[model samples]
Target: MSRIQANLLLLVIALIWGSAFVAQSQGMADVGPMLFTGVRFLIGAAVVAPLAWREWKQLARQGKTPTATDARHIGGLGLLMLVGAALQQVGIISTSVTNAGFLTALYVPLVPVLSWLWLRQLPHWSVWPGALACLVGAFLLSGAHELNIGVGDLWVIASALPWAVHVLFVGRVADKLAAPFLVACGQFLVCGSLALVYSLFMEPVSLKGLIAAAGPIAYTGVLSVGVAFTAQVVAQRYAHAADAAIILSSETLFAAVFGYLMMGDRLNPAGFAGCALILGSMLVIQLLPLFRMGRHKPASVLDHPV
Candidate 1:
């Protein structure tokens, strides 16, 4: 793809993902959070599996195909996403849509820190400051409420930490494997299976909720889980490691916008300030790469979805 085309693809994907904040916020009104997430992911897997099938067939014809290790790597990646996404969804149940949106976005900076701590390498200076800004935003946003740390908010923070790990894992996985196909297969199978299992155990979903929320459920299942996820897989291939992190962070802004438009939720002054700081921190990390002074990953060469 041309540079403009690649960047545009990533931008479009980011927009889809960012907009899903609305779908998720609306999804909880009709269904239990666990049930909603499980259902959406089940739909996600169904949509993505076919995309992977063609790639698998092409590789089979070539004979020299995916190694056993590659399958295991994919398994690990899928599992990471499965756990992180599940937690984030469940967390939203207790938290306000606004708080959840802001808190979960902390993963953008957490990625580099997690990488640094795991590898014994220092994160760039910007990583620490950005992470701090995220925490402050989280505190400001969540602190305004009763401050009764709900199960859902706790779940989201847990999700944020793991989501950071998932981001790092994506970089490695995209580098080692045929990115889009591997990502599609992993998300399809793992999240799909886990969602089904979780649905059976934690959330015996009622037919009424499903019927009442069909529009919302479908929006999330198809657009948020299926299309947005596909864009993430493809875009990650063409994004620098840090750029991928920054792009994904746009979900918060989109979330805020949707909240205002759909829910009549307007941020207070403090909230707006917090949001600005978080966004500014992310932009600095993404746009001022040299300021961070780290060895960033280059965009991967991968096939784009039509």
Candidate 2:
């Protein structure tokens, strides 16, 4: 797919995840974070399993089936997903969806930095300014000025690193595998299995709690995990990791909107300005590359894998 199409897919993923913040928060009313996370992802795995199997069969017919090494890499991605999801799920118990949304978005800035540090892949110059804008926007949008930092916020902040790594790693893997559904299914299975195992040992998982959280688990598992995350893996094959992060960071804005509509969350003038800044940053990053390409300049990080 074209880069623009990839970005559009990422945008839709952001919307799904944004709205899912409410489902996630409500799910904890009956279940522990680990249990909720585990059940939801297991549901996601089942949702995608058939598609993954079909993809695998097609690949086998072409003699391009995935290898054991691919399984290990995908497993590593699952571990990162679990850590990030667990931290966010736990953190959301004490934090408002607004705070959790923006705090989780801190990964937008971290992605480019981590890419540079770990992969020696420097993003386009525009990405630097765009990322800075996203950071400032996330801060203002989070309404942090009105509330003191709490333990939950700290956990959410800590989750950003693993999320950044997950984004970068997803980009690399998607580029190589060209099998987004299989990657999505494998990661979901791995994450779900590990989380369920952990929850069985540490948390009390009863049928009543599962029934109570069934609505949320179904919503999040089917839409957020199954659809949105699979779309992300597909989109990252064409979009740069840094650019994808910037685009996905718009989830904070969508979360704020959903929170206001569903949970009575409010935003001040500063919050609106923050929203504008994030939208502007996304536009700047996306548009700058087109202009650069017109000039026949060297391909930027946005146009190539990074």
Candidate 3:
């Protein structure tokens, strides 16, 4: 797929994830965060496993089957995903969703910085301003006026680092493996199995609670984990990590829109402005590369993976 197509897929992933935020919030009512996360991803793994099998078969035919090193790297990616998701899930228990949203969005800027520091890949110049705009927009949209440092806030902040690393790692491994579905399946299995194992010892998990949370599990497992995350893995094969981060950060905007429509949440003037800034930033970043295409090439981790 082309870069533009990849970006559009990332945008769709954002929409699915944004809309599923409500289910995620409501899901914890019946079960512990780890249980909910574990079950949902296990379901996601089940959903994707067939496709991954097919992908593996295809790669094997081409003599490009995954190596032990590839399995180790994919497992690492899963561990990062687990850490980030677990932190955000646990943090949201003590903090307001508004704070979690804004704090988690920090990954937008973190992705490019980490990519530069680790991969020595400088982003297109437009990514800096675009990422800043996305961060400010997320803050405004979150309706957080003052900086309040709470324990939960710190957890969410901590989640952003792994999330940023996860994005970069996905881009690198996906590009090398050329097997997006396989990557998604491997990560899901690793993350889900580990989480479920931890939850078994740490949290109470009853069938009754699982049934109560079934609706959320089905929605998030099927859409958010199964489809959206797999799409992200595929999209990042062509899209730059920095650019994907900016686009995916718009999940906050979609979350607000979904909240307003479904939950009767109202957005004030600041929220509207935040929406505009986010949209503008996404457009600017996408367009800037095109404008410079004739003169200079945009630097991307996908183009020069370390």
Tell me the whole-model lDDT of each prediction, alpha carbons only.
Answer: 0.66, 0.90, 0.87
Winner by lDDT: 2
Considering TM-score, which of the candidate structures 1 and 3 is the better prediction for this target?
3
Global lDDT of model 2? 0.90
True-vs-predicted CA distance for residue 249, candidate 2, Å: 0.3
lDDT of 1 by residue, 1-306 (tens): 443454566556656665676677667778777677777777876777787777777778878477877777777777877787778877776666666776677787777666567744454455566666755654554344546767777888788877777666664565556647556656657766776677778776788888887877788778777877776666666554444565566566666667777877677777677667756766665555454346654333332221
Cα deviation at 241, candidate 2, in Å, is 0.3
Cα lDDT of model 2 by residue, 221-298, tens digit: 999998899889888887888999999999999999999999999999999989999999999999988876766753
Error of 1 at 9 (Å): 4.5
Give the C-alpha miss distance for residue 273 in model 3, angstroms: 1.4
Query: What's the residue-level lDDT of 98 in candidate 2?
Result: 94
TM-score list, all predictions = 0.82, 0.96, 0.95
Q: Which portions of model 3 miss their true places by more than 4 Å? A: 297-300
Backbone clashes, each candidate: 1, 0, 0
lDDT of 2 at 50: 93
